[model samples]
Target: MSPKYTLSLWICCCTLFISCSANQPSEERSDYPEADSLIQAALSEDLFTGAVLLIAESGEIVHHKAYGYATLYDESLRVVPSPDSTTTRHLFDLASLTKVFATTYAFMALHTDGKINPDAPVSQYLPDFNTPQHRTITVRQLLNHTSGLMPWYPLYYRAAGSDDLIKEILSLPLSGVPGEARRYSDLGFIVLAEIAESITGMSFDEYLYDRVYSRIGLEKTVYNPLDKGMEDLVSTSHGNPFERKMVYEPDFGYRIDVDPDSWRNWRTYTLRGEVSDGNAWHAAGGMAGHAGLFSTAEDLLLLLQAVINPVSGSNDPIFEEETIRMFTEPDEFGNGLGWAMEPSALHAETLPQGAIGHTGFTGTNFVADPNPDGGRIYILLTNRQHVGVDGAGLYPDLRELREKMAKLVFGEQLR
Candidate 1:
């Protein structure tokens, strides 16, 4: 062959090989058309400033996507300075992921060691927790949020200190009979934290660090980054949606980098390196059994993996196989231990059986279905509170997005 012709043929062969390799499906690619569309839709609506959404089935992460910026320049615009790379780790507020990792994990550790009993009354550990109607409240009731306690109370403003806070929380009257109905209550979990501390002879935070977080190999998951040698990497939050514009004058909260110190005061408090929930933070951002956990998407996925397949890890199982089953399954009120269970197809024509997970108020959610042939797990972490705390409507959008993504990956609708 002529030298020019030989070279041309060699180049064409290399190009063909590259094209074939690019088109070849690696293990990572699983069908997820809905996931891609949902993420793009969330970005378009500004419903989430940034998010890390992942789906795993049969012990593999089938889909992973990162969208938007860690911080926003405007309500609809992303920050100019992106991470070191597109895949760089972004610190998410974690909102209520704290309940699963901090609260539920603490309960499991104590239960596994025989340090605490699920059926024991709260007054057994917290003597001051006694009430005529609430005397029947048990550890299990608290964990399942069926203790008939009020959903939430602003004990932070009413109480002077930690002791006062506990007293005030216990003093509140019950809304209904214990276990009569399912009422999601943060107060129940707050008392549960106290019970864990009283029985274990260690603070909830210390107990978790010693038994759960460290053992689980979660390097970045913590109650408060300020106390964990993580002064940096904490994101600042706007006090209200309009603080950036009206309250702070022209700065509009978004125009300039937030000055953490200026807004650290009690009023217009900007949450940075501190717990956002006032009641939970007042408890020192420890394992509150209700709120106060901060983590990244990767760290949370590790915890979920343990929950879904406990046999794969060397660390002790957080809950026994039976206990895990009980915790993840629906109870009398369609909720489980720290999780909300979806109804079976027979019970609710639109619902799916064995679909269990929890959503955090701070814009975090983890859902998992563990049927051997049809299991799926998803984690969506966002700082929806970045704008402020009032617009809870974003949760519905999140739910819809998750449902759509799940359908795309699992080929079955969640509801």
Candidate 2:
């Protein structure tokens, strides 16, 4: 499909949702006071600067609202005077949620087109992955994060450019035997994206927009929102301070294998409409498999609805029903293909076993229960980085608030 035609499809999708009574909503009249209060308290306590929350019960939007300030910090990272407020339309960087929404979707399209085999060694597409250890890695192992790749590596310092970043990642030693352990790895997804690009001959973000997201009626999901002419995005991070500390501070939880002074081009201004991830921005230029996608709460809800609530007995544009099942149905490893299942670290233990979702580093989350009896979707997006890090020099972790909200959203179907 041409970009022009896909844009028209996006316009129709946006208009159809806006014209519906269920899409545009006022939460004051809804019964989610508990969730509202939980978010409100977090904002009051400065957990984040702004947020957009959306909840869908059985495909009907029950609550959708924006709260707090969108552009909270100034260039020097200080709280601004009269911070700009946010609307539901403002985009927040989805961070690692890109793994499932962007990269996984592209993989599904490739699978449908008979371009990729889940069981095939990645060397089939990426020739550099032909090493004895790397040769044993399969696409499925990467999806389930069983590839035993180390969780992170700062390829930004080592890569000459995007072309060389993949080579740098492939040079790293595996953390464990492939398919034997379930350590989630951003490097694994970055390699997965390289495989997708190698196979499709398009940038990762372009592939998603052309083949998956736009085709599924998503108008706002994108890799670099500012480059696409989007303004007034939710702010994230003051320069790259937290990530900078991560590099120099050896005891910082995530291992950084590069020298602290290896890279000198650190960003020094507050981030808006730019990806917050170091590798995504510095290495991939806002188009990495692990992070960089930005989106709105409602656009994300529509994405969830596309696969979870497709038209009955119709040829779904994105993937076949069996394909969706392949990714959502958890194996004994406690995870679906690229998605995290319930009881995993990504969700509350109270959630039913079949619930599927993912979380982003920039304080974003989306989870949906596709069960006929428990059809519900909950999304919470907050700009936790806008307020900068706390005494520990880290962005406020949204996991506590995420768990609280998930419990309330799925209270009726808690396992």
Candidate whose lDDT is highest: 2
Q: List candidate 2 segments past 4 Å from native.
A: 1-31, 312-315, 372-374
Candidate 2, residues 288-369, lDDT tens digits: the string is 8999989888888877876786663446557767788888888777788998884656756558558889988888888788
In candidate 1 the C-alpha lDDT for residue 188 amounts to: 82
Where does candidate 2 clash, by residue pair?
none
| Model 2 C-alpha lDDT versus the unseen true structure | 0.80
lDDT of each: 0.62, 0.80
Tens-digit lDDT track of model 1 for 1-415: 7543453343334322322343222332425656656665665554554566777777677766554445543333223243211122545666556777778878877777788878888888887757676678888898887788877665654555666656877677777788787777888887777777888898787898888777778877877677767733434354433323332343432222234334433435445556656667654433466777777666777777667777675555755777677677777776778766653311122334677667776667776776645567777776556543334222223556655554555456443
In TM-score terms, candidate 1 sits at 0.77
Question: Quick one: best TM-score, which candidate?
Answer: 2
